[model samples]
Target chain A: MPKIVDHEERRAEIVAATMRVIERLGLDGATVREIAQEAGLSRSVLAHYFTNKAQILVTAHQTAFAAVRDRIAAQRAEIGDPVELLRVALEEAVPVDARRMLEANIDVAFWEFARHDPELRAIRLDSHLQAVEMWESMARDVQAAGSARDGIDVEAFGVETQLVIDGTSLQAVLFPEAMPPERQLAVVATHLRRVLRQ
Target chain B: MPKIVDHEERRAEIVAATMRVIERLGLDGATVREIAQEAGLSRSVLAHYFTNKAQILVTAHQTAFAAVRDRIAAQRAEIGDPVELLRVALEEAVPVDARRMLEANIDVAFWEFARHDPELRAIRLDSHLQAVEMWESMARDVQAAGSARDGIDVEAFGVETQLVIDGTSLQAVLFPEAMPPERQLAVVATHLRRVLRQ
Candidate 1:
C-alpha cells in the first residue's frame, strides 16, 4: 500500500464535496464536473470512485445516514437517560453544521429525483427505513429507561418521532428565520414529552 | 351575455384539472397542451384563463389552499373548541380524496420545479407564509378559547404545526404504508394535546 488510506474515509470526503455542490447550485447544477471540482480531484478520479452521478448521490446519502446513525449511537452511550437521549438524538438531525445542511440539501435533491428515478427511489426508501429503525431503537431504550409511560408503542412512537424530525428539517431549511435551532429543538422536546404514555 | 358563467368557479375547475395533470405527469410533463386536454378545452381557451403554466400552477395551489381554508373556516362555525377545530382542519389536508392526493402531487411537482424555477420558488414562499398566517389565526383561537397554556409562542407553534403537516404530506406520498390516514391523525392529535397549555 502506497499510503494505506482508508477507503471509507476517502469515500466520505468525496460525498461531502458532492453535498457542497448541491447546496450551492441545487440538484440541477450538481454535475459530475462540478462535484469533482469541489472535491479537488479530476473527473477521472471521481469516476474511478463512482460510476455515475446517481451512484455518487446514492453513496453520499448512505454516508450521511451512517454518520447520523453513529452520532446518535454515540450520544446514546453518553446519555444513559431515555428522555435526555431522545432530546439529544432528535436535535442531532437538525442542520446545526455545514455537514448537516449538506445532508439536508442532498436529501431534498434526491426526493425530486425519486419521483422519476427508480435507483434514487430505492436509495431514499432504504434511508428512511434506516432512520425509522434507529428511532425505533431509541424509543425502546427510552421505554426501558423508565422515562416513557407504560403501554407506549415503541414502534409507533418511533414512526411519529421520525415524522416530526423529518418535517422539522424541511421547515428549517425552507424558513430558517422562523424555525431557528432553539425553537425547533424546543418544539420537538415538548412534543416528544407528550407522546410518552405517562 | 352568453350565460355569464361563474368565472371564479370555472377558473377553479380549470385549476383542479391542472392538479390532475400534474399528478399523472411530472411537473415537466404538465404542459399547457396536457392541461388543456385534461380540462376538455382548447389551449387558446386555457390561455385566456391563465397566460402560462406558471400561472396555472400558482392558481392550482391557490385553489387547493382555498379549499383547505374554507373547510377549516366552515368547521369554525360548528366547532367552538380551538383544539378540536384545528384537529379537524389538519386532518382535512391528509389524503382523504383524490383531490387531496392530486393537490399533494401538484405540490411535489412544483417543489421539484422550484429548484430550477424562480417564479415557482416565489409561489412556494408565499404558500408557506399564508400557511403560517393561517396557523397563527388558529393559535390565537386556541388562546382565546382559554385552552392555550401561558408563555406559548403562538407563531412558533403555528410554524411547527405547518412543518408536521408538510412532513405528513410528504410521508403519505412517499411511504403510504408507513403513514396512513389514521396514524397521521393520531400523531396530529398527540402534537396538539402536548402543546396545548390547558
Candidate 2:
C-alpha cells in the first residue's frame, strides 16, 4: 500500500480537479465523470478516494475554505490588531478577487447541494461553526483590548460577522455589477465599524 | 393563437409548475420535460409557452419573487411606519416558514443558473434594480420622517438592505439549524434598528 502521505496528496489532487471543473462549468456540469476526466484519473481510481459526488464536493468545499483560512493566516502574521486581522479575514472570505471568486463559486455550488443533503448540511455547519469560533476568538482579543463597543455581544457579533461574509460573498459572486468588489470591501468596513467601533 | 389573457395565464401556470419541479427536485432536476409533466401539459405545449428551458426558469424566478413582493405588499397596506414596514418586508423576504421556504428554494435554484446564464443574469439584474428602487422609495419616506439616522446614504442603504435579505435568506434556507427562523427574525430586527432607530 502507498504511504498515507501519497494517499492524501492524491485526494488533494482530486479535490483540486473537482474545483477546476466546477469553476469552469458550474456545479451541474461537474459530474463525477467530468471530475475524473479533469483529474486525469479513471472512475474506479476516483471512487477509491471519494465514495460519491457529494463526498467529492464536500472535500472541494473544504479545499476552498482552507485556502481562505490560509490566506487569512498569512495576512494575520503582520497585523497586530485583532480587529484589523478580523477585518482582513472578512475581506479575504468574500469573492473580492479572482482567487476568492473561485472560492465563492465553489461555495455557491456547495450551497445548492447542501440545501437538500443532510450530510452536506452537517459538514457546512461544522465549517461555519469553525469560522464563527475563529472570529470569536479574535473578537475576544479585540474586546479585551477595549477596542470594541460597550455591551457588544461577542458571540452574536462573531456569528453575524460570518453571516456578513457569507452574504457578501454570495452577492458579490452572483451579482458583481450590483455588489462590486470595491463596494463589498467598503460594506465590510462599515460592518466592522458597527461592531468594533474602530 | 390564444387570447392575450389566456396566453399570460398559461405562462403563469407553466412558471408555477417549473417552480414546483425545481423546489422538489432542485434546478438540476428541473428539466423542460419535468416542468411540462409537472404542469400537466405536453412538452410541445410547454414549448409553445416558453421557447427554452432558460425562459421557463426565468419566469419561475419571477413567480417566486412576485410572491415575496405580494406578501410584503399585503403587510405594507396596514403599516404606516416606513421603518416598521421595511422590517416586515425584510422578514417577508427571507424563508421564515414553509411558504417563504418554497420561494427561497426557487430563488436559490435560480441563483445556480444565474451564476452562468447571461440572459438570466440580465433578468435578475433588472429584478434586483426594481427591488432597490422600491426600498429607496421607502427609505426616502423614513428619512423624510426623520426616523432614520442623519447622513444615511439612502441609495447605499437601499442596496445593502437587499444584500442583507439575500444573505439572510440563503443561510436560513441552507443552514436552518444555525439560523433558525427565530434567530433569522431577531437578526433582521437588529439590522433594522441599526438602520432605522425607531
Candidate 3:
C-alpha cells in the first residue's frame, strides 16, 4: 500500500515554522526562504502548501484565534461559574505565557500589515466582531446569573472589557517585566470586579 | 547677506513630509525615495537633514507625541475643572480626528519596528513611562481636589486608564466605523465614572 500524506498536518507545520520566523525576524524579515529553512522544507514544498507569505500569515492569525476560541470553549464546558468563565476568557486573551506572547507578536505584525492589505483587514475585522459578540454574550450570561452588577449596559461593558484586555496584552508584550502574568490577571480581575457586584 | 537656515525648522519639515509618505504608503513602503518624492526634495537633500529612514521615523514618532502633549497642555490651560481636565486628556489620547489617525498609523508601524530595534524600543519604553507619569500626576491631582473617588490607587488607576486609552485608540483606528469619536469618548467616560465617584 502506498503511504498517505497528511496535507493538513503539513500546512500546520508550515504555519508553525512561519510563526517562529516571524518571532525571530519580524514580518519584514519573514521571507519565504527563511520560513522554508525554519521548517526544514524546500522552497518548492512551501509553495506547494501556501500561495504566498500573506496567505501563510492569514493562516497563522486564524490559528491563533482558533486556539483562544478553543481554550475558552473548553474552559466554559468545565467551569460552571459564570464569573470564573469570564475571568478565564479574559485571562486567556492576555499574553500571560509563551504561547500567548507569541500570538501577541504575530498580532502586532498583522495589525501593521493589515493597515494596507484589504483582505487581511477584512479578516481582522471579522475576527474582532466575533470576539466582541462572544464577550457580549458572556457578559449577558454573567449578568443574568447575578454575578455582574445590575443596571450596567452589558454591550458597552463587554466592549470596554475587551478594550482593556487588548490594551493590557499589548503592554505585556511591549513591557514584559512591567506586566507579568500575575499583574495582568490582577488588572483584569480589578476591572471585572469594579464592574461586577461584590 | 547670506541666507540663514533654521536647522530645527528644516528637520520638522522633513519629519512632516516623512509622515505623509508613511500615511500614503506604510512604513515598509515608505522608502527613502518615496519620502524624498513626498517632500519634493532630492535624495541627497533629504540625507543632508536625516541620517536614514529609521531616523526620520523616530523623529516622526517624537513629533506625534509632542503634538498630543501640546494639545493636552493647551486644554489644561483652558480648562480649570480637574475632572474636565482629566476627561479631555483621556479623550485627546484617542484617535478621534484625522491628525490623531495619522499618529495612530505611525504608532502601529513604530510598535512593530520597535520589536526589532533596541533604540526604538528604548524610546517607546521611555515615552510610555513619561505618559504614565503624566497620567498618574493628573489622577492624583484630581483625587486631591476631591472630585475623584476616594481610596482609589492613583498609580494603578493611571496605568490602567492609559492602557484603556491606547487599546481604544488602536481599536478606533482598526474599526473606525464601529468606534466613532463619540463612542470612544463615551467608553472612556463610562470607565472613568465607574472608577471615580460621580
DockQ for each of the predicted structures, in order?
0.55, 0.62, 0.67
lDDT for predicted candidate 2 compared with the true structure: 0.80
Candidate 3's TM-score? 0.89
True contacts kept of 1: 0.56
lDDT of each: 0.76, 0.80, 0.81
Report the lDDT of model 2 for residue A95: 82
The residue-by-residue lDDT of candidate 1 on B35-109, one tens digit each, is 889989898988888777677767777777777778878998899788888878878866646667666766766
**Candidate 3 Cα errors over 4 Å, as ranges:** A1-5, A13-41, B1-5, B16-41
Tens digits of per-residue lDDT, candidate 3, A18-65, equal 878877876678788898899999899788877677887787789888
Best prediction by lDDT? 3
Per-residue lDDT of A34-146 in model 1, one digit per residue for the tens? 98999898988888787776776777677677888899889878987777887888878877666786677667766776777877887788788778887888788777767
Model 2 chain B scores worst on lDDT over the 10 consecutive residues at B189-198
The C-alpha stretches of model 1 lying farther than 4 A from their native spots are: A1-13, A16-27, A38-52, A195-198, B1-13, B23-28, B40-53, B149-153, B196-198
lDDT of 2 by residue, B97-184 (tens): 8878877766776787787788888888888888888888878888887898767778877777777777777887777778888877
- DockQ of candidate 1 (2 decimals): 0.55
The native-contact fractions of the candidates, in order shown, are: 0.56, 0.72, 0.69
Instruction: In candidate 2, list every pair of residues with a backbone clash.
Output: none
DockQ of candidate 3 (2 decimals): 0.67
